[model samples]
Target: MSVSSSLTGRTLIVMPAFNEEEAVGNVVREVKKTLPGTVVLVVDDGSRDATSAVAREAGALVATLPFNLGVGGAMRVGFRYALENGFDNVVQVDSDGQHDPAGVPALLEALDSADLVMGARFAGEGDYRVRGPRQWAMKVFATILSRTSRTRLTDTTSGFRASGPRAVALFAEHYPAEYLGDTIEALVIASRSGLVIRQIPVAMRPRAGGVPSHNPFKAAAYLGRASMALVFAFIRPKSIYRTGSNA
Candidate 1:
């Protein structure tokens, strides 16, 4: 796809941060450096630290939640922000710095043909590795989601993704807020809603700071929860989040 300069100019970059003060400031700056004048909003997900201040210090618009609400919750606020602010695209980037801002333009360019475009970590560009039960769960989830979306997806749980106009409008109303729902179950919602989904190769980076959300010991439990999230997503009624127009 040919990338248009206007595509990135009008896009909204939503970085969901939870106690990521250590890296968010520099991440925000990096985004500004890479994207150059694109609007970057940092949704401070109820961190006890000065995440909001740090983000603002780095020249990003900040929205603070009263309490922690995970990535899904923070992203919902972002979608609504984009909807209200005239942005036709919403890109979710992690503020902990696992996602490179430089990959964002490719995601937006993909919107020319897809309503949702994911920056895939396992699509032959990144050396990012996952193992054990978590890896098992990811492969299973990817296989199922690939079939459901009718498009192959190598990284079903990647946090780096962009939503086009259709996805932005739909997700603003229906985006999930549950554990593991943001990426995995969220794609299920988009698929069931008849949105086009696709992905492109992108490099993943080491976390700039903050604790990892999961670890090896939690792998078994993660597999179970991940399966449940996918199941619950498929079973949800369309009317729960759709109007006739969006449906």
Candidate 2:
């Protein structure tokens, strides 16, 4: 089924790009083809390359950031754009071409009964060519998150995901600003705030170019910090209730 026919509301795909000139255009094109009528937005996170221009040429509405705001910052900008511009659903996908645009429908389909739908690379028959150490670290983090959040999460680091109105509002208000732990963070926050979260297996492609931003030291730091963040986030009382009415 086509994306337009599947979705009951407007769906916007947000690509957070940083020096991804080579892949942005193709990524936008594939998303447009797979999800007809889906609007694309490229948040150029201070890319020194022609990422913005390529995305624009490929039919994405480009939003340029002044400096490198990291992935979380770029996604926050996209969330704001989606919220203010009145998009009913928002999907955050990377511009590095590792995420399959064709699988966007699966994510969207999962969103029908979930407040947030996350793509799980570990759950399906896909060539998940992740580095050994990074994969191990992700597994560890996923275990910790699942325990703390009282939910099962196969891929805590997957970036291919979709969010509905409640999630859009929550992220726009309180998405983490730094690091690659936003997936786990979002899941924990959503669970605490009583938002329904679901995950579906999706294929993840090998990265196209440039070294993956994660190294051993960086991975250690991320694991430590993300674990701490999740602990604090779990213990802290939620300020917002699950009900629509804010009491």
Would you give me the overall lDDT of model 1? 0.90
Q: Write the per-residue lDDT of candidate 1 for residues 57-80, one digit (tens) a residue.
A: 999999999999999999999999
RMSD list, candidates in order: 1.9, 2.8
TM-score of each: 0.95, 0.89
Which residue ranges in model 1 land beyond 4 Å of their true spot?
A: 1-5, 244-247
Model 2 off-target regions past 4 Å?
Answer: 5-9, 129-133, 235-237, 240-247
Clashing residue pairs in candidate 1, if any? none
Per-residue accuracy of model 2 over 19-109 as CA lDDT, tens digit each: 9987889889988877777889999999998999999999999999999988888898988888898887889888888898888887877
For model 2, how many clashes? 0
Task: Please give the distance, in angstroms, between residue 110's alpha carbon in candidate 1 and its true position after superposition.
Answer: 0.7
In Å, residue 185's CA in model 1 sits off its true spot by 1.2
